[model samples]
Target: MTDDSGADLAWETLYGETAYMCPGFDIQREQVRLPDGTETDFDYLSESASVVVLPFTADGEVVVIEEWRQAVKRVNRGLPAGGVEGEDVDLEATAVRELEEETGYTTDSVEHLTTVEPANGISDAVFHYFVARDCEPAGEQSLDFNESIRVETTTLDALREGIRDGDVRDGRTAMGVLYYDAFA
Candidate 1:
């Protein structure tokens, strides 16, 4: 069957404001008009790019971090992830930098797993996943002024158990684990 989805649809942004402007995602509010002549105001968070990495050691343990997130108000275990600064910075480089900064682990080899949108409902952010191998302790974590992370290393089985028991609650971490299990 031929798709005529666009024939009856119309969308227009009436007004918008950048709620949170930063180097990463920028949150904004926009007023839109639908096809049926209904108008609504919507909030959107947009980002240029982001990265997540599954850092693995020679013994097969994955390096993770226990960090307190303000949004969730609890410490959660997650893989290394962050946003890129600009087009000059490659995705793998961003993954490596985030891994080192968050977990103090450095990897010489990294393979791309996938790119995904963790939250599409209210945000336009793309998460690029990578599997990093031959990882070793680098140094002290270079976190932001507001970040407090404790690095941890665990086997894949333990991670799986954490997921099964509803302990690993971070979406990016879960996605990285699933991708590593399937591909890495």
Candidate 2:
């Protein structure tokens, strides 16, 4: 048997740039060399590192948020998530800030659960998953402009059921719940 695959392709990027600018992210363009030594242009999104926080109470309830997603034109239930603003902070800091800002849940005990890239084919964004145990209501939610969020708490079983029944529609939230259920 013989294996013929694109794996033998010697691909290289000639140059790249941020093509379009947005508030938080931008589109990137690059020229690439194919296996046949031919060149083509590649376009992708360049985003900063992001975080998803699975905040859990001492009694094992999970804190979640529901907010309007303009792209989908519906509200979504998801973990408190956001992108790291700058190089001055780390992933854990991003997790803590997002959790508090979106849900008003704060935790002194936070740990990295996992990192996922939802669309590596078109974006360079990494979603850092975090498990925040021993959380409590720290203060009122401080949302950004144009953000309206609702914070809710539910048991792990109920959360799983919501996902199974398609009530929870956010992919990162579903993954975060699964990770919390299995490991944290």
The estimated TM-scores of all candidates read 0.87, 0.90
Backbone clash count, each prediction separately: 0, 0
Off by over 4 Å in 1: 4-10, 20-25
Highest-scoring model, lDDT? 2
Give the alpha carbon lDDT tens digit for every residue of 1-184 in model 1.
Answer: 6448875565788888887887456889888998788999889888877788888998888898898988889999988887777663577778888889988899889888999988888788888999999899988899988788899899888898898788999988888788777776
Which of the numbered candidates is closest to the native, going by highest TM-score? 2
lDDT of 2 by residue, 43-133 (tens): 9999888899888999988898889999899998888898788673677877888899898889998899999888888989898999899
How many Å off is the CA of 125 in candidate 1?
1.8
Candidate 1, run of 10 with poorest lDDT: 1-10
Candidate 1 TM-score versus the reference: 0.87
Poorest 10 consecutive residues by lDDT, candidate 2: 1-10
